[model samples]
Target: MRWRAGVVAALAVAVLLGACGGGEEPVAATASRTPKPLPISTPTSIQQRCFVPVEGGLTTFTGPEGSTMPGAVLGEGADVAVFLHQTSAAGFCGWATYADWVASKDVKAVLVDLCGWGRSACKGGFAADAEAQVRLLVDWAREHGARRVTVVGASMGGAIALGVGQRAGADALVDLSGPAVWQGVPTAGEAAKETTVPLLLAVAPGDRGMDPPALRAAVKAAPAKHKRFVSTRGSHGWDMLNDGALTEPKWSPLAHDVLAWVKGEYRAG
Candidate 1:
């Protein structure tokens, strides 16, 4: 698959930011500007199984046969949320909070430890080779009778998910704190040009390290008929996890919004 050049440029920027010894100023500033309102609904939590093996070694994580991913399941039936963790993070790291949020909306949630990360084997890092692992996960989701798979990826995981959504089939793709382009990774625009699935591009207002302009440019280049951009407050991955203020809202309106979009697309077909 073809990677995005813009993503490469953005990754360079990230590296530069890191080299400058800068803290998360962009994200913090953005968060400060937004109102700290709680979610409208409280979400529940569910646990599930995932298992898959990659080139590095045999995966020992949970999941059904033919899959080796550690994840949790929430909600019921076809309304499912599949969460992909970032690099060096486990499925359970911040899964419960998101799972509970999804469950409150009655949406089943599946949080997976990606290959080479968490309990899964690592053949090569998040390089081009990671694409195979993503493909395997997508295939497993389809085989397991998943009516519709809505993928949410964070950081490196977001990059992987974008690659999968670009070439592999999926219902919807959500990019959280993921750069439009990573080092040798495809930009969301590049992925969008080839992907048929609905795409939601989300960026943290405070992520000065990230170039939202580049991401927006990529979205404009995407081929998907349905594409939307959302701006969230706080650091890249912090807001969605347990430590964030939106961890448990009285009403999980965000989950509902995501599910509504997925269901609309699934039903349209």
Candidate 2:
């Protein structure tokens, strides 16, 4: 009986102590403060800054396959169409060095790897390939909502540009160290007579296929009245566009002239 009473008294005391909070000033229950999360910010999409359809990349163009023409897009501005030609297996990014010119001229560039070249799965050769592939480039530009577009090419690319530019009536055409004697064009002179679009043909001083004589013949044949042949100092192909590369930032005289011609701001020659 005494043990049971003792147990009851102990239970009563515990209850009383708990109610009084052990009389230690009753430790205030501090509510944990959870800092409100800072506002999450959203960044602008890269596609907005660069071209939406195509972003910048290395030599190989990772775009669509087959007729899509594997290529990369450079700069954000537009109305200008740039079609790149291959000197070898290198990617079209090599021409990206001219982005400065493309920017200054408010131009957009599409570096193409034609059939059997770069990343293009489509197969064809030179002039024959140009007729079809160049259409793709033109169609791509049109799809992008470009109001005006030009075609720029290097080496064999230049010859292709001439073939397409003449037929397509491109806003302008830029040929950098291209050939005078392509399969169908036969001669730059012949290609020149076919189009009235503003044309700029640039050649390195000692290029094998585009020496001064050939350049003269081509220029003489250009009936645009605004056509010009700029002889520069550098290697062949697109390398001489500006200070030997599209990798270089500054605009060359060649780039300036081409841009001016495209802008319809050049004087008749």
Candidate 3:
């Protein structure tokens, strides 16, 4: 969940050494640098980076068809938030930062690799088998002491979350840039109509080829009494949860809104 501090230290050494080898007069290495160095904890575009799995936190589950699914769990509590990854090959690692953030709030964070992605390369790939496996996990969580379960997903995983949330009877749902229709599974719009739990539907305008207006409208008209439609300006799916969430290009309120909803503070906006 943290960036490597050695990278910043190495950069600082390079800058200081460069000052010592100056042209006209060798500048003192002890002199102050022009621009301040970035902090060690500064967040980058993590979703685009390759993530090594966290050491020793890995767990496995057996699907109905006997396939093994690997995942990691962070934090522990009666309330659980299950994260499904977007279509990216990075899989559940894409949700690592956000999951850690959720764990800090005392909620159990469940990060799964879905079926074909990450370490769970099953026979059927990302087909109906993946959704079935997620549904099984949801039930598994409930049986294992989760009082309330909220399913959250992005892109392709988002669409699967909607369907799984409905069929699995999750207490709440968060869908980020999920397509209305993905492959041959159930339509997200239809799943949205059937979702009775509190829902948060977030999408960036002009995200890839997604129709934000239609997606927003569908969530707006969903039967869930507590539902919100957020319009953000950022790259699609997992990229929306960035360090510059309050700044331009990432939109001012996207990350905050999602967290608020995650914490059960569902403001009607």
Winner on TM-score between 1 and 2 is 2
In terms of lDDT, the poorest run of 10 residues in model 3 is: 42-51
Listed in order, each prediction's TM-score against the native is: 0.64, 0.68, 0.73
The runs of at least 3 residues in candidate 3 whose Cα sits more than 4 Å from the true structure, single-residue gaps closed, are 1-56, 123-127, 244-252
Model 1's TM-score against the true structure: 0.64
Model 3 backbone overlap count:
0
lDDT of each: 0.59, 0.64, 0.73
Tens digits of lDDT, candidate 2, 188-258: 77787776887888887777756567766777777785777777787777666556422334556666666
Which of the numbered candidates is closest to the native, going by highest TM-score? 3
Q: Give per-residue CA lDDT, model 3, range 161-201, as digits (tens).
A: 77667677678888888887777456767777787888898
